[model samples]
Structure formats: structure tokens, C-alpha cells
Target: MQSSIIIADDHPLILKGLNDFLLEKKYNVLASAVNGKDALELIETHKPEIAILDIQMPYYTGLEIAEKCKALNYQTKIVLITFEKDEAIYKQAKSLGVYGYVLKEFALTEIEQCIDTVSKDIPYFSPELLSYLEVESTPKELETLTPTEKEVLKHIAQNKTAKEIGDLMFISNRTVEKHKSHIIKKLNLAPIQNSLLIWAKENQTLLE
Candidate 1:
């Protein structure tokens, strides 16, 4: 039987390209969607054999859609397409039980291979991304911090504001500020909010 597939991405060109390519390959393009919400709707309506999902979207992330599919007991094979090669996202995708994770920069031929592999009940990772995993080294150390400081860092990573974190931890606002100061000093991070967020996301697995 021909495989039925749905393509989801925010870019019109990407959606069209995938649709045309798959159609030419003799696969049935069951539906296409621009975001996670629409993708989930298409999946439920069509029950396609495969779903090709872009990781970044406006309404909800591809990972969110994957989780929903899992919850609904959908048996469709999922292929996540991403521009990012972040380890945290990679680990999260694996945890979501995705059949394949394809980097956006790979050739169309690679995509074909991924689809075929996933359809055959095998997992696939794009070659470029696989190489990244092979070469990444574990961090040696994070500067030692008190348990309270670690909690503060975790809350910050979760996007909590200083006052909000203070309320959550039942600590005074002055205490929160002091903890933040100490964290910056200990980590020697750049004195920028975005820099801190970047550090948090990049080192999330280490924190865990």
C-alpha cells in the first residue's frame, strides 16, 4: 500500500516543496498544515501513515504535536525536521518516540531515506546531526553553588522573573536579587539577560 503522509511547516515554500516531492515519489500527500494545531487536526482527520513535522511553528511546537499524537495512541511514524542541533531538543525528540529526526540542511535524498527507515520501524537521524552527537563532549564542571542558588537558576531557566521566583520560593525580593548576583558571579556569565537564557538552554541537560 502507498504510504499516506502529512507535511507541517510554517513556510509556504517548504510545504509546497514537500507536497510536490512526495507526490512525485508516489506517496499520498494526505494533508499539509502550517502549525502544530493544524497538524494535529490533519492527523486526526486523515490518520496518515507518516507525519513530517517542522520543529519550529507559530501556534505550538512540533514536539507538542508529537506528544499529542502519542497521547491519542496514533501509530503514525513521525519525522521531526529542525534547523537547530541543540542536544536538549535532540534528547527531547528521542524521548517523544519520534521515528526520525532530520536536519533542515540535508538533501532531499536524505529525507527520502529517513521516511523509508521510519516506515520500516527503524529510527533515523540525519548524518550531519549524527556527527554532532558523536563529537560532543560532556562539560567538566559547573561552578559550585548552594542548593538555594541552584533552585534560583532552575527557576530562571523556566523563565520566571525575579519577583515571580521569589514568590514561588517564598523568599524575599532582596534575597532573590542576592541569589541572582551570586549566580552571575559564580558562573562568570555575561551581564545580559539573553546571554543567561542562552547559557541555561545550552546547559539544560547538565543541570538535569
Candidate 2:
């Protein structure tokens, strides 16, 4: 059976284009809304199988609407369209049970795949977004290291021995080892042999 869908976006061109595309794909598009208010009303009234919402809509953003729908126990599956590649928004979407997250730039190319996946009771996120998140996560984890720990890590990345690092930093070997232990703990690396050295080598470019 054709999936019942409602799409909304503040941009007229995007809204029309998406509606037409879904129609061409033979899906039953019940309504289109220019704002989140109308979108939520359409969703509440039509109870579509999927609601494709723009994340930055007026009155209520997509995440806000998703939260409302969840509170109301609505069964409509949400597919959020956005230009944002932000981690906080993505995490909020996941928390609100959004079924699909498509980047606005890739909306036309990716929407069908998102719908297909969501229809099968699976969540879908843009592959590009996932890659961005993975890259972002590494920097965040690296941020946990103190300045001295990071300096120690950078030296380790250059294949520096503990004594060499201690000499370069004007610290003792014991202090260098202590910093190494702290770095490993902050990075949550295993206490196995050379794990800290291996991690530093692998992420050398990030250190620079």
C-alpha cells in the first residue's frame, strides 16, 4: 500500500518540490503545510504514516513538534528535513523518536531511501550526517584532555620516549608517566601494552 505522508517546509519551493516528488513516486500525500503549526494540525487530523517536517519551521521547530507528537501518543512517523548538521539537534531528534533525518541539500536524493527505511520500521539518518558525527565525536573526546596531557599526547604521537618527552617538557620521567596514565584514563583507552602510544599515533593528525 502507498504510504500516507504529510510534508511541511517554510520554503515554498522546497515544499512544493517535495510534495510533487512524493506524488510522482505514487505515495499518498494527504497534506502540505507551510509552517509547523499547520503541519502538526495536519498530522493530528490526518494521522499520516509519515510526517516530513522542516526542522526550522515557525511557531514550533521540527524537534518541538516531534516532542508534542510523542506526548500526545501520536503514531505518525517523523522524517525531519534540515540544513543543520548539528549534533545537539540530531541527538534531540533521536530522543523524540524521529524515524528519518535527511539533510535539506540531499533531501531529493535521500528522501525515498529514508521513507523506504522508515516504512520498514527502521530509523534512518543521512550517511553524511553520521560521518560528520563520527568526526565531531573524536574532537570532543580529545577536548577532555588537559593542555599538558595533550602536549604529552602530541609528543607521544611523534614517537617520543618517556625520557625524551620529560626532557623536552622539563618534567621528570615519573611525571611523564603520570600524564600518560591520565591521558589514557581521559581517553578511556584500555590499559593494555602501548595502547596510549597506538592511539596517539593513529590520531596524530588530529593532534596537529
Candidate 3:
């Protein structure tokens, strides 16, 4: 049986493009909407097998609608399309159990696969999205370090000894050791011998 699909996007061009593409591929596109409210209404009325929604829409965002569907125990699987590469948004989508997440840039190229994967009761995410998240996540985790800790990490990345780092930074060796301990804790290192050093070396490029 052909899966029933409902698509929603605020931009007319995107909505039409996606709808037309699905139609061209011989998929059953049940309905299309221009806003989140209308989209939600269609879902309630039609209860499609899959819903492809733009993340940002009037009245309610895609994430919100997905949450509502989950709350109401709908059988519809949601696939969110967005331009956002934000960590928080992606995390929220995963938490809501959204079936698919496709970036706007890759929507046309990836949507077919996304729908296919979701119809099989599997989750799909843009490959670029995962790479972007990995790159963005490092900077955020690095942000948790204090300025002093960052500098200590940089020195460690350079293979500086505690005494050498202390001399260069004009702090006492004891103080440098204290900073290293704090850095290890902040970075969640295993506290095994040379674990901090290994992490520092592996992430040296990011440290710079």
C-alpha cells in the first residue's frame, strides 16, 4: 500500500516543490498546508502515515506539533525539515521521537530516503546534520572551561610539562597542577594516567 503523506511549509515554493517531487516519485501525497495550524488540522483529519513539516511555522512549530501528536498517541510519523543546525533543536527533536530530520538545503535530495526510512519505523537524520552537530558540539563543550583552564589545555596540547607551563604562565608548579586537576574534572576525563594528555593531543586542532 502507498503510504499517505501530508506536507507543510510556510514558503509556497518549498511546499509546492516538495509536494510536486513526491507526486513525481509516485508517492501518495494526501494534503499540503501553508502553516503549522493548518498542518496540524490536516493531520487530525487525515491521519497520514507520514507528515513532512517545516520546523518553523505559524501558530506552532514542527517540534511542537510532533510533541502534540506524541501526546495524543497518533500513528503518524513526523519528518521535520529545517535550516537550523542547532544542537538544542536537534536534541529536542530526538527527545520528541521525531521519525526524521532533514535539512532544507538537502530536502529535495534526501526527503525520499527519509520518508522511506521512517515508513519502515526507523529514524533518519541528515548526514550533514550529524557532522555539523559533532563540529558544533566540541566548541560548546570547550566553552565549559574557564579561560585559565583553556590556556592550560592549550599548553598541555603543546606537550608542555607542568613546571614548564607554570614557568611560562608565571604561576607556581603547585598551582599549575591544581589547574590541571580542575581541567581534567571540567572536561570529564577518566583521571587515569595521561588521559588528559591524550585528550589534549587528540583535540589539539580544536584547542587552537
Candidate 4:
């Protein structure tokens, strides 16, 4: 049986393109909305098997809509469409019980796979994000962290700059930087790509 799905996006091209693409993929495209309000309404009304919502939408963001659905105990699976691959966003999506996290650029390449996975009540994240789960996300790597490094990691996840962390920790900015470097080394994250921050954002719940 074809999967019944609803999609929403502010961009006209994206809304139509996704509609056509899902139809071509043999999904039952129940409705497509150009704005967020309609998206939520359609989902509430139709209760399709899945709802694919763009992250940045007018009135209510996709995340907000997902939250509402969770509160209402709606059974429709949610797929968050986003250009941002931030780990913090992923964390929030996970908390919201989001089923799929597909980057806009990879929609054509990954959406079908994402929906297929979510259709079975499994969660799916963007392709590029899979590496983080293995890199610094291993339980052994996390276990190697000391108390001070863990504090710094929490600050990084909270979006605090090094200077801010230094002020809070009563340390010099240079010392903070050293600690950050150590944290990255221990986590096996890259030094240049802000990978530490990414890991922090994506794994906030773990730190808590």
C-alpha cells in the first residue's frame, strides 16, 4: 500500500517539487501546503501516515508544529526538512520524536530513503550526520572525558563562546582554548570544523 503523506514549505518551487517527487515515488501525496498553518491543519485533519515539514516556515516553524503534534498525541510521523545540519537542532528533533531529518539539498537523493525508514516507525537523519554517531559519539570516547572537559562541552553545547566560558570558569581565554582542544582530541572531533560545537549541540541530552 502507498504511504499517505503531507508536505509543506514556504517556497513555491519546493512545495510543488516535493509533491511531484513523492507522487512519482508512489507515495500517496494527500496534500501540500505553502505555509505552516495549513500544514498543521492538514495534518490534523487528514492524519496522514507521515508529515514532511520544512524547518523554516511562516507562522509556526516545523519544530513548533512537531511539538504540538506530540502534545496532541497525534500518530502521524514527522519528517523535518532543513538546510541546517546543526546537532542542537537534531537533539530538539529527537526530543520532539521526529521521524526524519532531511537536508534540503539532499531531498532528491535522500527523501525516499528517509520516508521509507520513518514509515516503519524508525528515525532517519541526514546522510552526512551519520558519521557523528560513530566519531565522538562512542560511549568509550565519552567515558574518556574529565569533569572540566565535560563542563566545557556543556558550555559549547549551550552556545557559549570561549571567552564566555573563560569568564564563567574563572580561567584565561587561552586556558579555555587549551581545554577545548583537549576535549576535541579526546572526542576525536576535528579542531578546525567547529566539530566540537557540533557534537555538543547534537548530544546535549547525553551531557545532561
Tens-place lDDT per residue, model 4, 134-201, is 44454467789999889989999999999999999999999999998888888765344677887788
Model 1 is weakest, by summed lDDT over 10 consecutive residues, at: 134-143
TM-score of each: 0.64, 0.67, 0.66, 0.65
lDDT of 2 by residue, 77-121 (tens): 999999999999998998899999999899989999999878877
The Cα error of candidate 4 at residue 35, in Å, is 1.3
Q: Model 3: residues >4 Å from true position, as ranges?
A: 138-208
**Candidate 2 TM-score to native:** 0.67
> lDDT for every model?
0.81, 0.90, 0.90, 0.86
The residue ranges of model 4 lying beyond 4 angstroms of the native Cα positions read 132-208
Error of 2 at 34 (Å): 0.2
> Clashing pairs in model 3?
none
**Ranking of all predicted structures according to TM-score, beginning with the best and ending with the worst:** 2, 3, 4, 1
Q: Candidate 4 has what TM-score?
A: 0.65
C-alpha positional error of residue 127 in candidate 1 after TM-score superposition, expressed in Å = 1.5
Deviation of model 2 at 33, angstroms: 0.2
Clashes of 2: 0
Weakest lDDT window of 10 consecutive positions for candidate 3: 132-141
Off by over 4 Å in 2: 138-208
